[model samples]
Target: MKAVVVNEGGALSIQNIEMPKITSPDQILVKVAYCGLCGSDIPRIFHHGAHFYPITLGHEFSGTVVDTGHGVTEFDNGDLICCVPLLPCFKCDECQKHYYSLCKNYTFVGSRIAGGFAEYIVLDKKNAFKLPKGISPLEGAFFEPMTVGMHALLLADGCEGKNVVIVGGGTIGLLAMQCAKAMGAKSVAVIDINQQRLDLAKKLGADAVYHSQKLSSEAIHQALSSSRFDQVVLETAGSPVTVNLSIEIAGPRAKIALVGTLHHDITLPEKTFGLILRKELQILGSWMNYSAPWPGKEWQLVSQYFIDGKIKLDELIAGMGDFDSFIKQVTALNGRPMNGKILLNCM
Candidate 1:
């Protein structure tokens, strides 16, 4: 098997490696099919290092089951599946409360262990799910990110029957928009620094789009036909600018979910901080999902939506290539602007 290995110095090299085998009775071995490149992968590959040197990093992926342990009854050979990356110790306090993401003893695929960038990866049967009928392997790869969006929307208090604003048009941001609409948002406006992404956002059900460079309260009001987004605002850009702007774009008493991650210290702007007080907004910081309502509802909901034809992710796919192309594309992702998700055909 071959995988793009991130060496200790953050250099990416495609190298032949031993294939992972089922190490536990509850585990399943899968043949990697399509893996999507995440924005976080950019820094993890070029700047921040992985959990260990020579690790393969790809969490948003889907594949066919090559073999399943005898204990696995739900899935069998050749069934398409995607998995929630978090592997929680069910005995922890957080896990007892079904908040797996907050579990103290959680491990992650593609981060803490070997992942989908390779020709084969192993997943605990509990973490793997068979893709619903009518969903292709590529669309199956969307399950993870859609779950993130679903979790963020839940943090924003459901998005039902109210206008919303999403402050980023990247993959996560766009998925958040779809989740909002699916949850019955009255309308949505997506703001981004990249016009190309904003255009893509509009094509994928964003009612309106704005470039952050020229955004203003009045401009956003005009776009959504309201003084502010009274329902919810999800900040997926994770910069000081977008997070603050989510505050500015929110209406009085609105709930704001900060979903993006900022890697460094941020000096909070005075005016934005004051707005929180004046508006009496409920500002919440959302992290990885609790996987609640039902175990893995995030994955189930996204899967059913795709199965029912309520959602289609064709527009989010920008390109497809082999392992080498994935490396080149991801290397340039952070510093450049691209509008869609790039998938690597791992065969």
Candidate 2:
């Protein structure tokens, strides 16, 4: 089997490796199809960010099942499925409470163990989700990211009939915008410094798009014809500026879900910090998408909405090709901004 392996920090190569086999009764072997490149993959590839060297790095992927272990009754050979990357320790207190994301011990596929950047991989039956009928492998690869936005929405108690503001126009931010609309938000507004992302957001159903570089937070709020978003505000950019803006634009008693992974320590301004107290805001910190019943409703809703044609995945794909093309694309992204998801056809 051919796999892309990062032998050490800042080093990557495509090497023929032994194929993973089903070692447990509750496992399945999947022939890799498409794997989506993530923002986190950038640092793991270019910097010393990976948990270990000589590891295959890809998690958002979909494929066809070639074999299923005897204990796997829900799935069988020829099933099209997407990988749920989070491997939670089922014995932990958090896992017992159905808070899989908050499990004290967790092993992520791409980060902690062998991942899907290869011709084939083995997965635990519980971590493999069958794709709905008519869902392509490429579309199935998007399930992970879609669930990310949905998870935040779920944490905020959903977006139906509410004015929703998503502060970021990146992949996750854009997906969050579409998720809000699909969930019956009265209006969806997106804020971003990138014009291309903002334009794509509009095309994907954002009622209003604001360029954060050109407009002040107050100006953006007024442009939306609202003093502040009283319903929901999702901060998905993970930037300090966007984080502060999320705080400033949230109305009283609003549900603010912090969905992005912040890389730096954020020192909120006195006034910005005061808003949390003054507005009596409900700050919801959402982690990876997982809840009761394992892998939860986020993944289920993403599959349903995608199959129903309510969610868009094609427009969100900025690039797609094989491992060689993926390498070139990664090399070329030298401080360049990525507008959408980049996919690698592993098979």
Q: Candidate 1 has what TM-score?
A: 0.93
Indicate the residue-level lDDT of 190 in model 1. 89
The 10 consecutive residues of candidate 2 with the worst lDDT sum are 221-230
**How much lDDT does each candidate structure score?**
0.80, 0.86
Off by over 4 Å in 1: 218-230, 293-295, 332-339
| Candidate 1, 59-164: lDDT as tens digits | 8889999898888998989899986677888988888888787888878888898778878888998777788778988888888888887887876668788888
Residue 232 in candidate 1 has what lDDT?
Answer: 84
lDDT winner: 2
Pairs with steric clashes in candidate 1? none
**What is the alpha-carbon lDDT of model 1 when measured against the actual structure?**
0.80
Return the TM-score for each candidate structure. 0.93, 0.96
